[model samples]
Target chain A: MTTFVDIQDVTHVYARAEDGAPAVQNLNLTVREDEFAAIVGPSGCGKSTLMKLATGLQFPREGTVIVGGREVGAPVKLAGMAFQNPTMLPWRTTLDNILLPLEIVEPHRSRLRKHKAEYVAKAECLLAQVGLKGQGHKFPWQLSGGMQQRASLCRALIHEPKLLMLDEPFGALDTFTREELWCVMRDLHAAQKVTIILVTHDLREAAFLADRIFCMSARPGRIVAEREVEFPRPRDLEITYSAPFASLVQELRGHIAQARAAA
Target chain B: MTTKRHLHLAPWIFTLGFFLAWEIICRVLKVSTFVLPAPSTIAQAIWEYRNQLAFHAMHTLWMTLAGFGIAVAFGLLLGMALGASRLINAGTYPLLVGFNSIPKVAVVPILVFWFGVGWVPPVMTAFLISFFPIVVNVATGIATVEPEMEDVLRALGASKRDIVFKVGVPRAMPYFFGSLKVAITLAYVGSVIGEQNASNVGIGNLLTRASAAFEVPLVWAALVVLAVLGVVMYVITALIERSMTGWAQRSDMAAA
Candidate 1:
């Protein structure tokens, strides 16, 4: 498969207030088309920073990040993102929040007014896909944490971006809700075949969803280990209880533990 | 339904009780009405000079509203500019703080001297007094929107304008309204204070004239009118806030 996103040896550093060390150094990654990839690490391991770099929210200090065969210079509109908090605007209905990127990003921006009804239908459809069909008029605060995250995922997909970046998107939900959303997201990735770069601490989540998991060392984060899950397509919760899935999760956990100890 | 009915009459019952207690205490103690007239005396004075008080109140109300409108306009524009630019905030913050600390009421006399006995001085005073809260609140609101949310928007390839209009402004609404409630009251106070010093007609001027003649009851009557006006304005602003934030409030209630 062709690489959809390619990053050379990239380095990122935050200017320390009291002259502390760098944040991340010499990071390199490539996500192939329709690949479900996960970056797993301990807290503050720069996994989130890697997601930012991948999505073009930030540029590397020393290397290039190329998405779809072009170097990323500014923020990219060709990707969607969701985070732990969901962070949907309180004033807007769920449908409106989902349609936000379409109203803002080009090709659709100029056509939004002319096709508002159609766009709203699309947003509603995405909401329905995420099991939020009748709740489109509800505001962010009206929904539970899990429901909000589901809506957020719908919002991310509404623009039909080729890449979806999730930063701890399930972290705030309870175990049950999180597992449910994991299935929802898995079904989504299966149906759409969109390239996904999920940053998560849950090794089980990574093992269940990702085709490949990249474990990172602590900040200045570097990819310390890469593991490929040879699971077949259309994975379900049953796979999480299987022997191979447990072993893979345990291995990833070991890598994270080793990374934490080394840091 | 019970809560609704209770809410309606609760304040009135307390007010009536308060006035009754005050009237009884003064009358029973044989306290002179000169210092603090019985509520009935103040009410009577208000009835007697209804026309004069109304005219003066109109003056104060017009000045307050006009100044408040101007202050909101300038505050929003300046705040948007500053909020959109970190460099501007750094540059203008100290200057704003310096200007804010200059005892704005003390400058009222100078403003009157500059603009003379007209609406301009009071209007300017109201603007000066009300502008800061709006600017600070709006800027803070815009600044404090979740950074991760902003990153998400930016990643989705939203323009700067989109980011401001969709994320920054809507996020700032609660903060802006909070400041606006406070600003409206301050605007009224500013207009009244300015009128006291400079105007020929206004609630503030009425109070000044009554004080000059030592017509204490009449002064209290004008104060009562002013308080009522302030309350009416506050209630109206609150209604506006409720309407605008209905979605957010309902959502919060549901979540809670």
Candidate 2:
């Protein structure tokens, strides 16, 4: 498959940060079209910075970030994003929250009022896919954390963007819920065939969901290792219990430990 | 259930008990009408001069509402402008603070000078005193849009206008409504101050004339009327707030 996203030796520094240290330096990575890519690293290792760069929320200080074969100068309208916090607008119901992107990103923006029924139906379908079928009428506060996260996922995919950027989207969820979402995510990737870049600290989560995992080094983050999971499609949660899965997780954990120690 | 029912009745019971205590204290101490009129004396005065009191009360109410309406429009516009741009907020914030710090009562005379002794002074005073809170609250609401939430929109290539309308304005509704309660009350104080110093009508004017004539009960009656008006406006603003921004209030607070 052709590369859908390519970051070439990127470096970025936060303008207001007191110490003036670059958040990420020499950060080289690439993801193929429709590939599920997970980035694993130690804390403050610029995983979030990389996500920002890829989405064009922040420009790289010294490198090129190309998404869908075009250099990202402004926010890439073809990308959708979600973070650890669901951050749903409290006033809007789950259905409306999921439809928020359409109100901003067009041709939907221009057509939303006229085609709202069609859009609402699509949102309901997404909710059902994520195991939240009838809960769309409820507000964000009324929903549990897991349910909100599910709604958040539905929202990210609602615009049907080519690239989906997730920054530790399941970081705050409990273990059972987190694992349950891993299956949801697996099915979403299979069904949608959208390119997903998941930045996460959870080694097991990374190993379970991603087809290829890129492990990064400590401060001024750069890729230290890349491994491909040879597991077949339609992954089961039960496979996570196998010895091979544990060893893969252990290997990723060791890389993170080394990255942390080196800093 | 019993405790909840008691909580519901608490405000009315307390208010009645408070007036009862005042009436008892006045009767027991035989306080002079000039010194401190009894509740009964005030009530009698309210009945005796009901027409004059009603006229002045209506004047005060209209003046306060007119000024408050203007403040709402101007403050909302200014607040949105301030909230949307960091440059505008930084440029005007210090000046706003300095202006707000100056006693609005002190500005009434200047308003009177410019507009003459009439409705203009009272309306201007009400607008001046009440607008700061709305501006501050609305700006806070817009400025505090969670960075993560903003990222979701920005990633969609949403415009600055989209960010403001979609996230900023809605997020600021609770704050804006909250400020209305404060601004409405402040508007009353402002109009009353203006009425006392510059205008020939309103409760404030009635107060000045009655006190000068030693009609102490009439002064007390006017104060009671002002209090009732203030409470009515407050309740109205609060009800509107509840209807508009019920989403922001937690269930516990909403119950209260």
Please name the candidate that would achieve the greatest TM-score relative to the true structure: 2
Candidate 2: TM-score? 0.98
Off by over 4 Å in 1: A16-20, B1-4, B250-256
Docking class for model 1 is: medium
User: What lDDT score is found at residue B74 in candidate 2?
Assistant: 94
For candidate 1, list the clashing residue pairs, or say none.
A23-A220
Clashes of 2: 0
Q: A1-263 in candidate 2: lDDT tens per residue?
A: 89999999998999987899999988899999999999999998989999989999999999899999999999999888988999999999999999999999989999999999999999999999999999999999999999999999999999999999999999999999999999999988999979999999999999999989999998888999999998888889999999999999999989989999999
Model 1, global lDDT: 0.87
Candidate 2 lDDT for residue B140: 92
- For residue A84, model 1's alpha carbon misses the true position, in angstroms, by 1.0
DockQ of each: 0.79, 0.94
Q: How large is the i-RMS for each model, in angstroms?
A: 1.3, 0.6
| lDDT at A243, model 2 | 96
For candidate 1, the TM-score is: 0.95
Candidate topping lDDT: 2
Off by over 4 Å in 2: none
* CAPRI rating of model 2: high
